[model samples]
Target: MTSPRRFDDRTDAGERLGEALRDRDVDADIVLAIPRGGLPVGRAVADALGVPLDIVVASKIGAPGNPEYAIGAVAADGAVWRNERAFERGGVDEEYFQREREREAEKARQKAERYRSGRSEPDLSGKTVAVVDDGIATGSTVRACLAMLAATDAERIVLAVPVGPPETIAELREAVDDVVCLRTPSSFGGVGRFYDRFDQVSDADAMSYLKTDP
Candidate 1:
């Protein structure tokens, strides 16, 4: 049997998340969504908050033989978030981790450039930026993205998501200025479990959301 869902879809979740942010009185200067699932959610959030939407790219560095298991993540700007426990469990060495980080960082950079389509990188200096994603699982990529943002001159960085596990959300709280997660289920199996319509978002469709006027 399928699990009960809290959201009809990504857009629905995003709308609800936006409302939550408004209730918190978060005055964000921009919304940066993690593609490709984050764009739809970010679109709704940007529209609701009357701000411009953009993309922040990150790629997961998986375990050596298990590509599905993320041992770490790297951002477009080369900032990295290493899962030390995963590394120890997987027996991943510095050489392998460094190699994967470099490779994945390049891929992330290319993806960001493609999504931007010649637009220069936004100046986040002294701005209140909200980072949105569909949800958080292990939060590897989100951590890497947050690490990148932390290195910037931005005054505040907020992480907004539709849902996440209680433990993950608690840990993420320390990484950002504020968090605006709508749901933090203790029995979470996965991010898709809380969504009735969790579909894979294509690059083209995701990019279209960025073009939407907020």
Candidate 2:
């Protein structure tokens, strides 16, 4: 029997993921990381690929009475990705979903503005863009972010992550041109379980990764 694989930290996972992308010949024009946890990973990946790093923000719309359970997600620009099955299971009504969507969209917009710090959104037109994240669990936010990217004029979109559950990864593949995930565990529990140091990242620390020298 083999022991399950683990990553030392987000940076470690990013380095490995970067190498994997290189090995697969993934040529990205820019790297867009989902903050606040994806910044460190995206910084490492951007450094590895010698490309600029940016952010794509999204907020999950949690189900009623289950704040941690996401029924959908909304992006900074108001793009949304809904999980119909989760909505049905959670007994989410259109009115509740619409209300949560507006609330979360504002949250995502504010977060994106804070992270950008006055910089204009990058022009992904005719560019190959890679979307990075620390890892994925339910992937609600990632889906919302991807939906926003798909609305852009990007020539190609790639999703890069360190680890995720097999089913989520498979579902995500249809949302992007390419998916470069380092590990897809069959019996995955959560993203944190695969990391040795899965500490929550603060906005300050996360934003620092966007610095040229950070």
> How would you encode candidate 2's per-residue C-alpha lDDT over 1-214 as one tens digit per residue?
1124688999998888888889889999999999999999999999999999999999999989988988999999999999899856758899999999999999999999998999999999999999999999999999999999999999999999999898999999999999998888888899999889999999999999998843
Candidate 1 has its poorest 10 consecutive residues by lDDT at: 1-10
* Deviating ranges (above 4 Å) for candidate 2: 1-4
What TM-score does structure 1 among the candidates reach?
A: 0.96
Give Cα-based local distance difference scores for all models.
0.92, 0.92
Collision pairs in model 1: none
TM-score of each: 0.96, 0.96
> Ten-residue segment with the worst summed lDDT in candidate 2?
1-10
Please count the clashing residue pairs in each candidate, in the order shown: 0, 0
Q: What is the lDDT for 119 in model 2?
A: 92
